[model samples]
Target: MAYRPAGLRTMDEAQDMPPQSPAPAGIGVRGWLRWAWRQLTSMRVALLLLMLLALAALPGAFIPQIPQDPAGVATLRADRPQLATWLERAGLLDIYAAPWFAAIYLLLFISLIGCILPRTKAHITALRAAPSRVPRRLTRFPVRDTHTTTATTEEVTRAVRRALGRRFRVAVTPEGISAERGYLRESGNIVFHLALVGVLVALGAAQMIAYRGQAVVVEGRTFANSLVDYDTFTPGSMVTGDDLDPFTFTLTELTSRFTVDAQARDFAARVVVTEPDGRRYEDTIRVNYPITAAGANIYLAGNGFAPHLTVRDAQGQVAFSQPVPFLPEDDFYTSRGVVKVPDVSPGLDQLGFTGYLLPTALAEEDGLRSVHPQPNAPLIVLDVYTGDLGLDQGIPQNVYQLDTDNMTQVMDGAEEVKVLLAPGEEVELPDGLGTISFESLPRFAAIDLRYDPTLPLLLISALAAMAGLSASLFAPRRRLWVKTTQDEAGHTLIEAAALARGDDPGLQRELERVMTAVRATTPTTPEDT
Candidate 1:
């Protein structure tokens, strides 16, 4: 054999080795899938997915959602048809239910599960094992101390064990004593991720089984908990009519207050609710303060005026007599509304009216404008149309808008007919069609009812996540070592050092504290080496 140094190879031996081959072939489908899964399950991907979910929800806040505000969406579509089309196509109007948003949410959920399982297994293994063995060279640690004392090795070891046992998991051997603590740091990290997964699951359940409905109830009118009673109802995938609580509520009164400059000050809606068990109670709904009825939350969403009107045909038969809600158009309560009289007498064309209601009517140079939000001088300015009102066509239509596409505008001589009437005023329709009367004006309340069984779980999970995150951020993970040796002078030489998993500002202080505990047990003062 050639005289080769230990751990050395000769030229012939090196040449016999296999050459570094060209880059391996492309990873097969299975390998590629494994790589993808690993990448998707990484913490970085989970955080990125979370961020994407948050960003995707932003559009729902700014744009009008069909489930929440169909009227606003209708107006948007009418005003900006192109933009509305693009938004609808891109799912910006209904972001939370979008397929892409759901994909990110599902991916995040899977990633959290994937990360938690492996880490939890490892943590269990670590918990079963003892503290790591003492390092060969304790002097290599940044936080270190040495004490020369008259105490024997046995005394020094006992004191060190006693002191460190209070807070750390200690392991004593002939070489040294090894101690570790702050397992809760990793535990809290795992707990935080688990809590986040719980939150996501709760939220998904809520989305799948919850229901929300909105109804505009005029004062003295009853609203029943049924599909037909709601002006807008958005039900989750698993929700149905039977899922709604059987209840009935009537808006008894709605009070409003406004500042001099037409700024709204306060609004309250008093309602009488009848539960499914026949229990009746009176409650008030205010902005930001919701009332519970039949196990569902009733929120006061809006308040406006509904004018009580009566229409009579030429035969003196009552055609339409009910309150019609006029949606507000401006801060001053300049409202626009429509009335379709589809039940006119035989041989007479249906009647339709499109008009504006000025709460505090003021005759300006251009036209009538509202000066305040209060109904101090309520007036209605309407234009009459006579033809098919489109109610019997089975196609859903917006109640607040009038479709004059198949109707003819009533005319007086050479000009289009327009009627301006105050409260309790009666006006004769041109061409002997009918007589319209504005009887009274009563306030209406837009009440929203919501039900979700997973709300409490979601709340608890969110709070737990915050707590676990706090523990993970503040708790410190550190390892400590205490070694004892005999010096030439026959005194015990104690050496202690600490190593932390991350930056620990109190590491040096901890070393000092352990040293102090040792000094207190020894008979002689500690001498620095």
Candidate 2:
């Protein structure tokens, strides 16, 4: 018979009692914040954020970026204003620089740091501490072995410790010797995370400090490394015109080849570069072969022909005289160009010519087009216009397009007037407007220059990350124990066992090695030891 305490409730009474204090107030804001932090800093969340970053970058690849392809973006806007407006509103046109994209990048960076720091701290602590103690029952371990030898316990213990100490960190315990190896697995994990953080930092720095520009250099004409000289220049957030390298280069010659079917075979350009210190050198640029100068890489992106022309007003005074680069329209070099002669004689109206330059002219049934990529039958056919060239309007215009809004096409009877000329050929303009001469043809090379100071750091970080990942994946982590005791029969009994942190196919073999080491030092009997 037992007597219960007077104030203590029986099982029935406790069951009938009500809940206490609303279950302790539901974990408040601070507790919830701690939970959120733990979730965000988890390795799973870090990987998820990385995947999200990659997914967010996919749209940037397909969309025409405003910084890299401003013309393409402009054309999209002009063709589909509504769609373009929506894309702009969503920041797809400048996806890399978008606020949401930056947020994801920053979050991924922070998550990686958070995940790495705690793991690093724990790993350091583990490395400094001793190996784990041996289990009480070695026979229960998945990989275990027992051996009976005619030797003392001290001899077996010495042999086991010496054998395992060669490869593992051994610690003496009351039960036996505890040995551990492959801390490098955790070390590699920490290094991989650190490298990822480094890569993020380097990328962020590059985005803020790098700059790129494109310029067209005609043969025999020099191109200066300046903002005004570049046809299109995109600077980083922290970049400025003053940051451009002070250098100049002139396109000396161009060599191009085409197949019989008008497909391009090869293109190479020779340029003379002059550094800021007045040192000059010649370099060749071909497709995929870039030149490094003034801390920037110069790549030959495109090649075309620029026809030199001299235009004279009615008074026979030179009005516009320079080379005009034509944009290629086909594989055969059927090019289109516009000549805006806004600087005409004082009393004469401004003249404009919109035309096509056929490298190897061929008269087709539908129209005229180039038959070859070379200048075998070079010809320029143009339609003449007279107007207020709109130069004083302070509005930007495409050099390849002519605005006919304030212009009238010259007419000869019922048809609009047209002029045709070949190299060194001259033609008189109608109404005594001017005389236009095709002086010569020179090749032009479109080059892109880019400078990023963080490229080397980014490359190193990427390589380090790969190496650390390999180590983490291939290096095995294991903890082993070797216990020895003397039985009443004056025989030493040995129990060897191994435990792996993760999947280790060699755990059984490792335990066998320890058992073999113990046997080597002791006299074993043929009793299934």
Candidate 3:
């Protein structure tokens, strides 16, 4: 009788077990509860979890992330409040960081571990066991061949052994020979499943230890890795302010060029960065090029011009004279911003202001428009206001925007509506609030930097998964048996057969070659000649 493994018998018994009595059905009942739990833990359920993980990652990559584009998200929410609220409740805004997405990935990893651990142990045990005995009915096997020979049974067995030794895992018996090969397939399957778990663990570690942030570098400004230096930041759960790197870099120069004749894609910037250790790294950072240093990568995401301006009171004393960063409203040359003069030498006068249109600014029938981003024509249209500029209040205000809520427009009539000021020109305030003078313009670039230490581990896990998959899919397990008996005339009668647990085309061909080689080497006997 053929021996069957204990695990196989247990599997068969479990499948053969009778079904239990049907339970009463209702909404939110015990029957549905039990069914849901059973489905969630099953292999089919785990496969569904894997599919869900793949689907959940799609939106994060396809959609503009709120973490990366907060301004865009704010605009979207403002335009569609109801839809944004629904998406937020469904965890669509931040799908990758959501609890439900994490749960799916975690469960998939658990299922992979559960399936691989026992199979790996079983494969190790099977590899150590002795080769199975040859069956008595060799002719009934899937592959069988016979040939009469004058050579002794031992001689025939030796010839067969030599041929089988070339490629297969073989063992000789007194009757004939038994051989087996291709256990690597099972080993590979286990490896692939284990690697998947490793990948998930690496991703989880990255999420728990990585940090992303953006820091502004003004011209000739030097900054260290500190919370105060960063404009926006997103830190991993385990990362604290003290964990930041102490390395610092100085912005030696920042320059940009705009295409006067071509499209917006022709714009570019060159930034010079000098490390604290006196190492100089000069790189021409473009739209696609990102600089990496000190465990962080910096991307040249955007840029705008900071115009140098000087504000003076009626007495000719300088009130506010510095480079004010003007945010570009659109990609065109039209930039909009405010200039506030709360403190003046003449007196405590409130001066609220709005920037005028630059030269090359396109004007439609209604208002001013920018034809191009380049400053080919230079002009500034000023809108001034005078009132109580609430700068002494505890509440913070944006420098790029003016709070006209507490101020009154001083120049609202046609004669004062649009005061055009050319380059190196000045506009005198009617109420002795201040005098505005345009100076030079300097460009500034926005950069986003990120640091993740678990990238190497993630790559290793990916390679392991590939290796495991190749092994499992190409390797196979097979067995070969040879049974020999002497006929009445004292001549040896040999019968050889082969079988495989799984189909192995390569092993089948190898077995056929061995049988043919053995037949050719064995001597044939004359019968009644």
Taken over the whole model, the C-alpha lDDT of each candidate is 0.89, 0.88, 0.71
Clashing pairs in 2: none
- The digit string of per-residue lDDT tens for model 2 on 44-136 reads 998999999999989978888887778789778877999999999999999888999999998888888889889988999999999998888
Residue-level lDDT of model 3, residues 357-410, one tens digit each, is: 563665579977667776666667778777777777644455567888888887
Q: Model 1, stretches more than 4 Å misplaced?
A: 1-111, 150-167, 260-263, 408-417, 512-529
Could you tell me how far off, in angstroms, the CA of residue 404 lies in candidate 1 after the best superposition? 3.1
Alpha carbon lDDT at 230, candidate 3: 77
TM-score of each: 0.78, 0.77, 0.62
Q: Which stretches of candidate 2 lie over 4 Å from their true place?
A: 1-40, 43-108, 145-174, 257-267, 313-317, 329-334, 345-355, 360-377, 381-395, 402-420, 429-433, 485-494, 502-524
Ranking by TM-score: 1, 2, 3
Q: Kindly give the stretch of ten consecutive residues in candidate 2 with the minimal lDDT sum.
A: 520-529
Off by over 4 Å in 3: 1-42, 48-111, 130-168, 174-181, 216-218, 254-292, 301-438, 474-510, 513-529
Evaluation by lDDT, superior candidate among 1 and 3: 1
- Model 1 is weakest, by summed lDDT over 10 consecutive residues, at 520-529
